[model samples]
Target: MKRIGMLTQIFIGFVLAIILGVIFGPSIAVVQPLGDLFLRLIKFIVVPLVLASLITGITSLNNVNKLLSLGGKTIVYFLATTFFAVLIGLAAGFILSPGKGVDIALPTESAEKAEAPGITETLLNFIPVNPFESLTNGNILQIIFIAIAIGIAITTVGEKAKPLADFFEALAQVMYKITGFIMKLAPIGIFGILAPIVGNYGLDILLPLLKVILAVAIGCLLQVLVTYSIAVRTLGKMSPLAFIKGIAPAGIVAFTTASSSGTLPVTIKNTQENLAVSKEVSSFVLPLGSTINMDGSAIYQGVAAVFIAQFFGVDLSMGQIVTIAFMAVVVSIGAAGVPGAGLIMLTMVLQSVNLPLEGIALIAAIDRILDMFRTSTNVIGDASAAVVVQHQENKASLAKSA
Candidate 1:
């Protein structure tokens, strides 16, 4: 019965959203507020979730070096995966020719003329001058780095911080519970969000870019199913098929929710229940993944950058391609958990090559439609990591048993 209820709600939400969006067009504006509300609710919880979860996850670990090792491995894997994703995007955008011969006019927005941050400032600002303001402004990397520091401090204080440690542990549990409760409304929120999205653009939006979207989706799926599968099967030594199965719920939820952080709770739940990962690992890794490991979004940004470049009749040289790859990696790190995030990241990429910012307005029309695909891929990547983590622990357990 629980299974039935889950399936029913999800299916209904998706079907209804598409139907309503197609029929009403932008007149679905009434429901647009729900999308904003839903995103706000998710944003409201992110800071607390990171602080509590990181503190608890960190304090629980006896070996601080293991945390560093995990961080290093995760970042290395994320970078490799993102680099490949960017390559796939650039290659496909170049090969399939997504932006060729279009009569689309660019939208005029005042902000388009403004300069985006340079590589150095963007890097420096990541550390944050004021941590509190970073949180207030929704700077995810800053918030994450701060949580890591707080967590390490809690660990270092040891017994002296027992009471505080206990308090944060409880706080983590509370946040997880709140996240669980809020997730129940995801179906309704998804419906409300999609109703207007479909209404505003309709299927016609995909007309020009369907092939490109498909190419991008293929690249995303390859990253999740192929690249991640190898990581789980070889490095983590899990059954790749089982890993994919475990992540299905989270992937589907991501597809529907389209917010990695918003889907974090679902990813955690799915990792534990379906993937059989330990709570400790899931608690530690999933939140961080939500912030920094956006393999799917990275893929979209790479593809979209090249697509925009081509669409605007901008012929990028080999050096420019390398530049795009470099910029994509850096911008992707800063893009964590921002709503409609890929568009912003793509804007940064376009500006790097001196491409017209007007190109962004063209992509904006179809961004929501393409976003659904990439978000699913993002959640899949999260689940794959959880599965790999579990696989490593299981191997350790087996060794101990032997």
Candidate 2:
């Protein structure tokens, strides 16, 4: 019955948002408040949910070594999956040649150069100098580091911090309840977002960059279907079909919202409730994955690099491909946490290789469309990781018991 209510409300919200968007047109500003409010509510919960979940997830572990070992496996899977995604994107972009064009004058826009942080600086930044400041500013990576630190601290204190640990355990459950409550409004938010989206831009907006958009979507599908499924089968040793079925809800939310962080709640709910990943694993991995493991965005970066290069008729050397590969991995870390932020990161990528920023306008029109698909792929990747992580953890526990 509760499930029915959630589904029903989602549908109504979706339908009404579209109707009002079409009817209100420019006046979407009125209902826009509701959508903004919804987004704010989700944003409000992200930090607390991540912190609480991580604290609980890590401290609950009796063996700090197990936590570290699991972390290694999780990261290995993340890097492996993202590397495959990049390859798929590069291949698709090369084949489609979406940048082949007759004529479209580049826009006169100065590219915002990304402040390229050194490898040392990037590594140093992860160790939070001040944890509260990281939380206040919503520096996701820093917050994660802090949470894990606190988790380690709690575990070190052991029996002495049991009460404190229990509090966080309860807090994690409470946060999940809050997430479920907000998700009830998802359909309405989806409709409202789409209505203003479609009303303002119309179908004509898509016609210009349709080819590039389609190519990106195809690349995203390839990553989700090929890379993820293989990871689940060989590494996790799960049936690929079951894994896809498990992560579908997360993919849907991601596709509609285009925000990986925003989709975290749905990802958590689906991973734990529907897919049966342990709360311990889902709680730890999903939040970390949301901020870092962006297979879909990495793919987009690769494909976008090729497309921009093609548009400018600038031949990319093998060295440039290697540079793009390195940059794709780095840019994805920054891109996932920012909503509607992928394009800005893309601009940085093009400028790194001296591609014309003006070509960005060619893809900007279709950015939102591609974002939906990329985001879906991102969440799917996260959910798949959670399932594999949990299955392995369970298998280990059973073996020890035996």
Specify the highest-TM-score model's number.
2
Backbone clash pairs for candidate 1 read 21-199, 25-199
How many residue pairs clash in each candidate at the backbone level? 2, 2
lDDT of 2 by residue, 1-402 (tens): 355755455556666766776676766755565666667777888888888998888987767998997798788888888888888888888898878882665545534444545556767888888888989987777888998988999999899988988998888899999998888777656765666765676656566566678778998988877888887787677788887776775676677678888888788888887778888798789888988888888888888889889888999999888888878877776564555567777876776788877766766767787888788888899888887787788788899999
The TM-score between candidate 2 and the true structure equals 0.90
After superposition, candidate 1 runs with Cα above 4 Å error = 1-8, 32-37, 108-114, 135-138, 239-241, 393-402
| Prediction 1 global C-alpha lDDT | 0.74
CA RMSD of each candidate after superposition: 2.8, 2.6
TM-score of each: 0.88, 0.90
